[model samples]
Target: MSALRRLSLSGLATATAIAGVGVSTAESAPPPEPARISDVQQAARAIQGMTLEEKVGQLFVLFAYGPDAHKPDTRNTTLYGVPTPAEVVAKYKPGGWIYFNGRGNVESPTQLATYSNQLQTAAINTGLHVPMMIATDQEQGVVVRIGPPATQFGGNMAHGATRNTADARTAAAITGRELKAMGIRQDYAPVADVNVNALNPVIGVRSFSSDPQLVSDMTVAQVQGYQRDAGIMATAKHFPGHGDTRDDSHTALPTINHTLEQWNTIDAPPFKAAIKAGIDSIMTAHIVVPSLDPSGDPATLSKPILTGVLRQQLGFKGLIITDGLEMAAVRQQYGDAEVAVRAIEAGVDQLLLPPAPDVQFNAVLDAVRSGRISEQRINESLLRILLMKLKNGVLFTPFVDPAKVATTVGTPASLATAQTIVDKSVTLVKNNANVVPLNADPRKILVTGWGVSTTQALAASLTKRGATTTVAQTGAAPSDAAIADAVAKAQLNDVTVVITQKAWDTTVTDKLAKQQKLVKDLLATGKTVIVVAVRDPYDIAYFDAAPTYLATYGYAAVSMESLAKVIYGETKPTGKLPVDIPVAGQPDTALYPFGHGLTW
Candidate 1:
C-alpha cells in the first residue's frame, strides 16, 4: 500500500472518534513518544509512503468546472470526462483548486464556503486524505474575483499613490480574512513588479510604483498582512518581474531585455524583500530575460532563471508556482503534455491552472517513470507543499463553517477601512481653474464614462450628496452618437466629470482616440470638464486638454465613493502619482512626473 493509504488508514478511526460520531475512542491508544514526530517528519514519512501517481498529483493546483462541487457540470463533461468536482478530485487528487471569477466558480460568500467544504470532504477522503490548498486571485481592486459582501480594497497602485504602507497592510489583512472565511487559504496577491515601462500592457495599476524601493516596502507590508495578520499564504507574483514589458503574457510571450545589472537594480528588490519578509510563494512570470538565461525560454520553463537565479541567488525557500499553464505564452512554447514536465524540471513546485490537468498529470507521472524526472525530485516539492499546508492550518482543520462567512466577510467596519484607503488614494492631478469643490447649489453634474456601472455608481453617489446628476454613458470606444449625446448633456450641465478607462493591456489606439474625441467635444461646449482616469492613469495623457483631472487607479465601488467625496468637496484629494504619466505618443517622456497632485 502507498504511504498516503497508510496515513489515511492510521488516522481514519482517530478522526471519526474526535467527531463523536458513535466511534469508540476506548479501542484506540496514543502513539508512543517517538512516533510523536514534528510536522516535517510526518510530511516526509507520508511522502515516503506515497505511490508514484500520488506523488505527482501533489504537484498540481488545478481548476475544475462547477458552482456546486457535488453537482454534475454538463458544460465540461467532455473535457473532464467527469460530471462533478468530487469526481475530478477522485481521479486527479490534485494538491489544490484555483478559483476564477470569470469561470463562475465564485457566486457568494456562503455559497463559496459550501463549495469549499464539499471539495475538502472529497479531497480528504481521497488518496492522501490531505486538505487541498483552496485559493483565488483576491488581489482586491479591479482584479477581485469575489465581489461585494466582501470589502473592496484599493489595488497596489492606489496604495503607492497614498504613499502609505499601513493601507497596504490593512487591505491585505482584510482581504486575507475574508478569503479565509470563504475557506480559501491562499491569495495570489501584492504584485511586486515595479512598473517602469509606461507602455507596459499588463502590470500597470496592478503594480505599486516605478520606484523599486516603494514596491519593495509595499510588497513586504502586504505579505505580513496576508500571512501574519490573517494567516493565509500570500503570493508575490511574476518573479524576476513582469512590469516593464510592452506585451501581456496571457496572449503573447513577452521578452524583458534588462541586463543582469539593470534587472538587479530595477526588478530584483521587491522579490528579494518579499523573501526576506517570509512570503509563502513567488509566482513565475512567462517572460524571457536573455541576460538571466540565454535559452530564450520563458521564466516559467527556464531552469537558469527558476533554479539558478530565483533559488540559488535569491535563496527563496518557499513554494515556486507557475502562472496559469493555459496562458498562450507557455502553451505556444510547448505542448500541453510537455509544459508541466518542463515546469517541474525547471524547479516549479506547483503547476497552476493547467489547460489539460489529466494530460499534464499523466505526463509528469510518465516523466518520473522514464527517468526524465526522478522520484526524489517529486518528493522535494511534495515536502514543500505539505509543509505549507501544515504551517497554514490546512492540514488538520480543512473544513470551514459556512454560517460564519457572512459576518466575517464584508463587515461594515471592513468596508469603512476600504473606503479610507481609496479616499486617501483619490489623486487630484489638476484643478486648472480651482473649479473643483464645486460651489454651485443644486449642482448640475454630467457623469459620463467608459463603464456604465462605474458611471451609474458615480451618478448615484453625487445624487445622494444633493447634486442633480445626468449620466450619459460613453463606452471605451464611444460612437459618434454617444459623443454627440454626451456633448449635448455637457452643455446643459455646470460641470462634466468624464471617467475614462484604458485597461492595462489596451493596445488599440482608435478606441482611446474616440474617447479622447468625446472629452475634447465636451471641452468645446465651454463646460467645466473634470477627467478621471479610473483604470490606468495614462488615459489623461491621451486627452490632456481637460482642465481638471483625477486618478482613482481603479473603478471599484469604494473607489467611486471616494471620488464622489473628492468631487463634492467633502474630502481633500491627497493621492500623488505612483507612476509618471507618459505623453500619449512618447513612451519615454513624462507629461506629468511622479508625485504630481493638486489639493484644495
Candidate 2:
C-alpha cells in the first residue's frame, strides 16, 4: 500500500474520534474511511465532468502579467504564446490563473485586493464558474512581495532567535490574514529547507534555522498558523532540501552530495514532520542529489526523489509543485518542451510559471493523446489539485470581496509590530573600551563610505538628526587620494565615523585595503575613528586601528538608522551576533567571538 493510504487510515480514526462517532459493538469495525476529499479533488471532479479541451484548459496556469513583463521573445510575442486571461477565456477556458505583478504602482494590501478581485472576475467570466487560485510569495522579511518595510513581517532567523513557536505561528497568521484579505488563497511560504550552510547565497535568513529539529518545529507552527488560524493553504518549499547546496538554483543547478542514509537522517526529517503536521502543499527544488538520483537531474525532474522519497517514503499526500521553470537552472539545462512532460510524469502535479506555456501545454496534451502519459496519471494529479482547493473552501465558491485587506496589510499597527521585532533582532557583535556613545558634539562630524552618500534615502534620515555629515563616494578600493582627503577632514573634526557598506560577496576587498590605510592615518592623529560595518560583521577583521567597531547585520535604511542611534547612546546595543564569525579561520582565535555584545 502507498504510504499515503496508511497515513489516511490513521487520520480516519482521529477524525472519527473527534467527531464522537463510535464503532458499533454488534459488528466488525466499519471499513476504513477514505481521507477527506481535498479541494484539488473537488476541482478535478468538476473538470472530469467537462470536455477534453476544458480538461486540458484546466491544466494550464497563465501568468497574471503578460510575457513581455518577463523577457522579450523572437516572435515579439510573449514566450507563453498563450493570450491574456481575458483573451484566453474568450477562446479556450483555462482551469486557473496565477498572478505575478498586478495593476499597482506600489503593492499594498488594498491594491492587491483590488487587483485580485478584478483577476477573479475575469476568470469567472470564462463561464467555468471556478474561483481561481491567487498566489504570491509572502515569505516575509527581506523577500516580502507585499507590505511595506515598516509593516513587513520578520524572517525565519528572527523567529529562531526568539525561539518562540507561538511568535512564529503568529507571524504566519499575520501573513495569511493579509493574503486572504487580498483574495489570495495560496501562500508559498514557511521555507522548510534547513539552513545548514552559512554560505548559502539565496536561502539565508529565509530559512528557520541551521538545526533540522528546530526547522521542523517552527515549520509545524507556521503551517498551523497559516492553515488553521488564517484559513489559507500553506506550502512547504524546495522539498528534498535546498539548504546545503552552494550554487543558487535561480542562476544554476545546484548539487547536494548527501548519501541516501544521510539524506534520511539530515535532510528528510523536516519534510517528514511537515507532512505529519498536515501541510497542504510541497514545492520541489531545482537541486540534484547525486546519491538519490545518479543522473544528477533536479529533484523537480527526478522520479526517485519526488515519487520514491517524497511520495513513498515521506508519505506526503498534499499537492506537489515545481519551482518556476523559468529559472536559469532549469531553462539552461532542460531546453525542450518534453522536459515539462517528464516533470509531470515524474510526479510533480503543478508546473509553476513555466517559461513557454503553449509549448508546455501542448506537450502535456500530446502526451495525454498518445500513450506516453496515462490518463490515470493526469487524473491522479488533477484530483489532488482539486482536493486542495476543496480543503481551502475555494472549489465551488464565487468571488468574494476581501474583508480585511486595507486594515492589516500596511497599517501603522503592523509597522509598529515590525519595528518591535527588528529592535529585538539587532545583535551587537563587539565593544572594546566602551568607546561608544560618542562624547563629541554633533556639529563637527565627518562620515565617509559607499552607501552613506549614494543612497539618498538613508542620508536624509541622518540629516534630520542635526548632524553635519560629509559623505565621500569611492570605488570598491578607495584610492590613496580619497583616503588622504577623508583623513584631512577627520583631523579637523571632533568625531569621525566611517560607514562602510559591504556587498553580498564582499566586493570591497581591494578598497578595504585602502580603507585600512586611511584608518591608521586618522588614528595616528589621535582622532576617535568609529568603523561601522553595515553589512556583515566579518568586515571588522580587516581593520586593526579603529578603536570602535560596530556591525548592523543588514544595510536596510531602518537598520542603518538604528545603528546610528546605538552609536550615539540614544539606544543601547542589545543585539548579539546571530552567526559565528571566526578570526583567521579559527573559532577559538576569533577577534570578536560569536555572541559578543556590549551595552553602554
Candidate 3:
C-alpha cells in the first residue's frame, strides 16, 4: 500500500537554484526550492561573488587521504595526476569530502573530529568561506566506515527481517544522531537496492528486502528518521537498483537487463519513496541498464537516466550524486578527466571519491574554461550544493569541538537498541531436527569460519552461555591441514557449526565452491552440521544438506550476540528471511521464497 510511483519534483528546478539569479538562457527552468526563501537568497548572494575556480571546486567531493596526506612529500604513484596538499588547498579547493574505512587514518573519535575540523578549516581558509559536505558511508550493517564505539545497529536486511518500519526508522535515527555527533554532515545510507538476486555479492544484506513495497517503506522511514533526528542529509542510493546484479560495480560494470516498464515496476519503488519523502539526495548507480540507454553506458554516464529519467520524468527535487567515480566501473572506461566531464554533463551535481582529486578538478576546470561545458551548468550544480549546505546548517556552522566528539558518538542507549534489533533479527530458516535452542545434553559445539576473530567471537559468546565451544578457520578456502583439524573436531562434537562468510571478489564462486566442499566434508563426518550464514542469505543454497540453517545478516557484535542468544533460547528466533535462496540442487527454482523463515 506504499506510494508506488507518486514522487513529483514539480517546480524543483526553479526552487533549488539561487533565487532571482539572472541567466542568459531565457527559457531555462527556474531553480527548485529546497531551502528556505531567505536561505536561497543568501546562497544567491554568495554565488554572485564567487570566482570560476571557487565555483568549480564546489562540484567535487574528494577523499581525505589521511592527516599526513596534507604534506607535499607523501605523494604516491599517480594514476591520473594526484593532487598535492598545497595544490588542493590553494588551486582547486574541493567543496566536499567522503570518508571510508582507513581513509583519514581515523583511529579514534578525537582524531576523526580533529581531522574533519582541519578539512573544514582548510576549505574556509581558501577564502570562499563555503562549508564542505563531509560524508561517510555509514550504512550500518556491513559497510561501516567509522569503527567501534559507534553502535553496531542492525543492517537493512535485518530491519526487513523484523518487517517493521518503525524499528528501521529508529535504527536510522540512531545512526544519524551518532554521525552528527562525530561531525559528519552527510551519510550515504539506507541502501534502497532491492535484493532480487540472491547471488548479488555486494548488495546482499545491505538491501532491505526482495519485496519492492517492503524496500520502499523501509527506505522512506530511514530517510525521514535521519533528517528528523540528526538533521543530516540521508542519501537514497545505488539508484535503479543494484539488487539484481551478479557483479559489483566497485570492480566492474554490471548491466541490468530490465526494460523501462520493468524498471518502473521493481527497482524504481524505493527511490520513488525516497523522493516523495523529501529525501535530500539520490546517488547514481554505476550499473548499465540497456532499457534506458542502449549505448551500454552505466547510469552514472547516461544522460537519459540522470537528466531525462531522474530529473525530468521522476521530478527529483534535490541533488543527484554520482557513485564513487574512482570505482573501476567508470574508472576503467574513462580517464579521470572524462569521468568528471561526462558525469557533470549527465547532470550529476556532486562527484564522489575521484581517483585523483587534482586531476579531476583540473579536467573539469579546463572543460568549463574551454566552453565544452558551460559556466551556467557549473552554476546549476553549485546552487544545489550551496542549498544543501544551507539546509543542513553547514554554511554558517562549520566547526566541530574535538573534545566532544568521542563523548557524543556512542551511547549505552543506542547499543541497547542495537542489541534489541539484533535479538529480533537473527533469522532461523530451517531446523530439520529442531537442532537449534541446543536441547542436547552437555552440548559441545565447534564453530568454523573465514575470520578467526569472528569464529572465536561466536564461540566465546556461546561459551558464556555454558556450552563447550571451539573455533576453527573460516573455511573459505580451507587448507588440507585445516580441513583435517576441523574434521577431527567435528567427529568429537555433537554439532559442527559452519559460520559461512561471503567473499567480495571476482573469484567469489570459486571461494563458495571451496566452502561448499568443506561443509559437505563436515557432513561426511556423520555429525550434525549447523550452517550459520553470518553474511549472505544465499549461503544456505550452497550447503542445504546441513541439518540446520541460520542467517544473522551481519557480523557485528550485536549480530554475534544474537546468534549466541538464539542458540541457547535466551533470545527466541523470531526473524523471517527477507530474501529467497535458490532451491537446493535446483538452480532454476526458488525453494525458500522472500519472507520465508522458521523458528523453534
Candidate 4:
C-alpha cells in the first residue's frame, strides 16, 4: 500500500476503533488525500516567491501584549525595557504574534474582538501585509485567557466529569466561536495530556483523564469541533504528553521515564489521535522523553523526537511549534543562539516567544550561511507555516473592521452561555448536615476565609441577595486572635462559612498547611462550619472535621460568583468533583474521588 493509503487507513481505523468497531478489509478503506494538489502547488509557488529574509521571518512567532487589560508582563519588554510590539514588528517582521495580555477585557466579548482587530491592523501596517497569525492560550476552564462570561467550558477536569466525547465537542465548539469572533485564528488548547500522575502539579486539572483512549477521543473531538465548526485552527499541546510527570516544565525540564513501548501505549495515544483528526499544529514540550531521544536534550531540540518520531513515524505534516523558548526549561539549559539553531535543525517550524529574537534570528541566519543549517530545511518549515495560513483563509484576505469584531465576538448571549456552563460545572460534595443553601435566616450568617478577600465580588453578590456576611482572612497560623475573630462572628451568627483559597504560585504547600490549621481551629469551636474549597479539591484532606465541604475547582471571578449563588439557593450546584481527593498519604484516593459530586 502507498504511504497515503496507509495513513488514511490508519486514521479511519483509529476512529472506528474509538467507536468500538473493526475495519474488515483494505478495499473498504479510503486513502488520505491532501488539499487539492493545485492548492499545495500554489502555496509552494508563493513560498518560492518569498525572499530568504521573509522565509526566515515566517519561522519566528513573537510575543506581544494583547489588547486585553489582564495580560501578563511579557518580561521581554516591561522587565527589561525592550522594544514594544510595534517596534518588534517593524524590526523583525515575525510570521506570527502571540498575545501576552492587555489585549482587551475578557469580561466583554465585544471588547475582545475590537482589541484583536486593532492589534492585527498594527501588524499588517508593518508592510508585511501578512495576516499575522494571532494566537492565545484559551484552554477553557481555569487557564482561560478570555473571561468566564465568554466561555463556560472550565478546564479539562471539568470536561472529563461528563465522560462524554460529545460534551467535549460542545465545549470546543463554544471555544472556537468565541476565539474566531475575537480575530484569533489559532488557539493553543485541548491539552492532550492524560492525568496519570496525581502529583502532577501543573497538568493536574488541565488534563482530561488518565485513560489513554478517552483522552484520545476527547482530544480529537475538541480539535475537530474547533476547526470544523468555528474555523479556528486548534493546536494539540505539550506534545509527547506532559501528564505523567510531577514537575512543571515552565520552571525546569521534566524527565519522562517511559520506554518506547510504554510511551506508544500511554503518552502517545492522544497526539496520534489528534494528528489523525487533522489538527492544524502540534506544540513540542520542553520535557525530555529519553525513550525517543536519549541525547538528553529536550524534545523541542531533538530530531529523533520531532522529525523521526512525530514527522516520519507519526506522519504529522502540520507545523511543529516549540513551547516558549523563554521558559526556564529551555533557557536555563541552553544558550539562546544555540537553542535557536538546534530547534530549527530538529525540524521545528516555529520558535515561540523567543527570549531574544535578534540573537536567535542572527544565530539561525549565521547557521544557514555557515552550512550548519540547510536552506532547504528553512524552506520546509516556511512552506508548512504558509500552508497553515492559507488553510485558515488568512493569507488572501485583508484585515476585518474592529467594529464588526464585537458583532462576531463574545455576545451577551455567549456570556450567558458561559454562565450556564459554570452553573452546571460547579459540583457539591459532602453535604452531610444539609448545610448548603444556608436555609437559615440571611441575618444569621458569617463568612470568613482567605478566599473571601480574593473573591469579594462573590461575597458582595451574596450580600445583595440578603445574606449577612462577615468576611475575614485566615492567618499563616491558627492563632487565638484569629480564632477569636472567627468564633466571635460565628457566635453572633447561626452558620459559619469558611472559604479556603489555594494560590497558583510555589507557596501552595505552605499556604495549604496554614489554611488546614485554620480550618481545624475554626471547626473546634463547635459551630456549624461549612468549608468551601475555592481551589483544587485536594485541599479537602486538611479539614475532614467539617460536615459540609464544597469544591468550586477554581477561583475565577465568575466561578466565585457561581459559588456564592449556589450557597444562597439562587443557583443549584450541579458540577461533580472532576478529580478524586484521596485521604492524606493514600496512593489511589485523590482528595475527592473523580466524578464525586451532588446536585441540588
How much lDDT does each candidate structure score?
0.85, 0.65, 0.77, 0.72
| Candidate 1 backbone overlaps, count | 1
Question: What's each prediction's TM-score?
Answer: 0.95, 0.78, 0.90, 0.84
Residues 1-600, candidate 2, lDDT per residue (tens digit)? 222222223233333343233322222343354456654443444655655555556555555443222222333235534434455443445545555544222345565565555555455444554445667777875565664532455567656545667877877887787777766788888898876654466776677666687788889999999999999989898888998876889998889888888787777888888899999989999988998899878898989989988899788898888888878777766765867887887898887876776777778888888888887788777677666665675543423444545666656775565555555555555556566775536666677665643334344545666666666554446778887887888878766777664322333357546655665676677876777765545556656446677765445555556656766667776665544444533434656654566665
- For 1-600, candidate 3 gives per-residue lDDT tens digits of 001000012232232232221213222453343444465665666677788888888888776455533544344225324444334554556778777676444676666666666666566555565557888889988888886888887689998999988889988888887777656889998899898876787798999998899999999999988998779999999986888887889998998998788789889999998999999999999999999889888899889999998899889979999999878998777888898899999999999878777678889889998999999899899888888877887765555666666566777777888798779998888898887887636788898867676788788888887779888884577776777788899998877878777732235666756777777888888888888888877776766677788888888777888998898788789888887777654645887777788875
Model 4 agreement with the true structure over 1-600: per-residue lDDT tens digits? 422223224344343343232334435645554445565675666566566676788898876554442233465466224435555565676788776445433435566555555454454444444556878888876677776346555567666655667667877887887777666789998899877775677887777777788789889989988999888889898888888786788897899998889899989999999999999999999989989999899999999999999999999999899999988887766899999999999999999988877788889989998999988999889878877877886654323444455555556776665566565666788888787786636565677776534447566766777776667665434455776787777777777777775422233566655667667777887888888776556666766767888866666666667777778777787776555676766757665676678767
TM-score computed on alpha carbons, candidate 3 = 0.90
Candidate 1 lDDT, tens digit per residue, 336-368?
999999999999999998888778889998998
Candidate 4: misplaced stretches above 4 Å?
A: 1-37, 65-84, 102-115, 122-127, 440-443, 451-454, 473-488, 503-509, 564-574, 589-592
Q: CA lDDT of 71 in candidate 3?
A: 46
Considering TM-score, which of the candidate structures 2 and 3 is the better prediction for this target? 3
lDDT of 4: 0.72
Give the TM-score ranking, best first: 1, 3, 4, 2
lDDT (Cα, 0-100) at 86 in candidate 3: 30
Model 2 TM-score on a 0 to 1 scale: 0.78
